[model samples]
Target chain A: MKQGAVDAVIRGLKAAGVSVVCYLPDSLFKELYPALDADPDIRTIPVTNEGEGAAICGGVFLSGKRAALVMENSGLRASIEPLARMGLGAGIPVIMLMSYRGDLGENNWWAIPHGITMEPLLNAMRIPYRVVRKEDEIETAIHDAYEWAYAAYYHVAIALSGEIVR
Target chain B: MNRFDCMEVLSAQLKDELVILSLGGSVDEWYNAAPHMRKASLFQQQLGCVTPQAFGLAVGLPHRRIVSLDTDGGMLFNLGILATLGNEQPENLFVVVWDNECYQSIGGPPTHTAAQRVDIAAIARGSGVKEAHVATDLATFEEHCRKGLAAREPYIVVAKVTSTVRRDIRRKHSDGREDKYIFVRHVEETENIVIMGPSEHN
Candidate 1:
């Protein structure tokens, strides 16, 4: 992730009233983690897995504060059940900021399944998401996700792909 | 000891302290034990989330006391949270697990702790929690909750309970959405903040 994009994520999350972040590191978004950890206003937590991160983010919402779960798209698969339980069953929203792992970028072979299953899984969960490719749209994508999620009492996803993560 | 006995002791110490109960038999018992207390319990909605969500609540409200009425089965399902909780070690968090040794609801099969296959308190300590203990009797359990609540430390107490059900607990369906709203509103009211429907929210 570019420094500009990293800064945009931090600012956007703060602007969207997300004061805490629970993340499981993935190589694609490695740089963003440190910046998030150093931010003074945001309470950053390093989770053992994406499932733990999703539930932690839900807890943050329950505590009268907004939070975001940052991770690779593969973590989405790990978090699906809790996400479903929270979003679909309880109307608790988890604003997810994930790195698009298996986009059109011809990279690692392990990345293929991530791209293939990402959208279909999102659709299956009825979670609204946008795959962001440009740097300029990163902030708005995050800001809008928090907005839409809180209003509808639903979860939203924003995957940074293309130039933003590459 | 039974779950009701353990919860009654803990409920006696609560005053404006927030609680998040694990899914299953523990929910109705806690509700029955302390009907007016501020609490949230996911009824058959999500499994293995009570502790993690309570951890989030503790982190979110660093100044307030947060309790988790977690279960042995739920704890086994997501043991990784122990590492995270120990690592963070939020001071306002207090965790109490009802270790009944089996899945009391789903035909009563033995869980990891049934024959001592897993020790949750030890795992929590190994994971990084500064204080963790096992209470087999009501007196030990009460002492632990009293001291833990007074100190407001990150403490985990695994209370051993029998598979016996409490006939007095009123069984009913608590929809996840309904619990969420009521719980959130209680937090807002106690904390003096507006939590519901906030875009540029605090």
Candidate 2:
């Protein structure tokens, strides 16, 4: 039996000592929401929007706890304000795990804009990111994002694309 | 009563509880009212984010009480946070929205709360915040603050106040970034946990 993507993501989050997660569900990661909610060690908060999730993550950071914001790549746009003010302005870091919605070979025509604007927007914010395509690489990407994010006191993102999100 | 009077009453009822002030006016008010309270920090003008940030603090540090002095304009920026708050319902969080009904810091443009009669308390209740209340007077606002802060349930108080804000008060901290450091340090000391990672300063 193959290891599930959700399990892999959970393992990575645990390894990074992430106790809290603020998420806004998207179709790409709908299954992950239930798993995150059920996990005893992880506190999952369902936010109304990605901006709320980002701010919540910032608040968690202020409490001396590790929190991650998990959302769709399109949500990166929604969260830019909080991310910019909190991370860029105030030096509070928020680690994000986003699902790559409009990646290559995507079937939905509407999702293309999400992909088209994703990398550029992230770059404009000066947020370092990695698009992880392999299931085996999920945990490393998550762990790496946290390590550097905390060290630099800056926002970092790992987008699950390729087969992982597909 | 005046916004400062409400803040003074709120300032009088403080101990180790964490305070998160909204962008401009509330931050200045909190600082002037309680200058040495490092546990209280100013989150820069990220309207629509302050209440959710307080919600995060409440949920994350369940042992500590989190109070957010959010503003009407700030709440209107992202009213969706009320629904999230009502849904998550962290018991330790107490929110007080100072409803001056306008953008007081930015030259007094009327917000929906002023023009369209946007009842934030009603909206909060509709969104599932059972403990939401509106305080048009200082006595009611103080009562809500005094009791709401002590309650073990999630609470919200929409304090309708005047648009008058004092500009003479100076910031205790140099900038939001400095205040952020102070806030993190206070939590690290009081909570006996290390929050800041290996940065250049560390």
Strongest candidate by DockQ: 2
Model 2 chain B worst lDDT window (10 residues): B35-44
Q: Worst lDDT window (10 residues) for model 2 chain A?
A: A1-10
lDDT, residue A35, model 1:
96
Q: Mind giving the per-residue lDDT tens digits that candidate 2 earns over B1-202?
A: 6888888898888888898878767777777887656555655667887888888888879999898888888888888888987777788988999898888888888889997567999999999899999998888888999888988777999998988888788755567688788788888888888888455655
Q: lDDT at A114 for candidate 1?
A: 93
Q: Stretches of candidate 2 above 4 Å error?
A: A1-3, B197-202
How does candidate 2 score on lDDT? Answer: 0.86
Q: Return the DockQ of model 2.
A: 0.79
* Model 1 chain A: worst 10 consecutive residues (lDDT sum): A144-153
Residues A15-126, model 2: lDDT tens digits: 9999999898899898898899999999998888899899999988888788999999999999998899898788989999999989998999989999999999999999
TM-score for all predictions? 0.96, 0.96
Each model's lDDT: 0.86, 0.86
List the DockQ of the predictions in order: 0.77, 0.79
All models, RMSD in angstroms: 2.1, 1.9
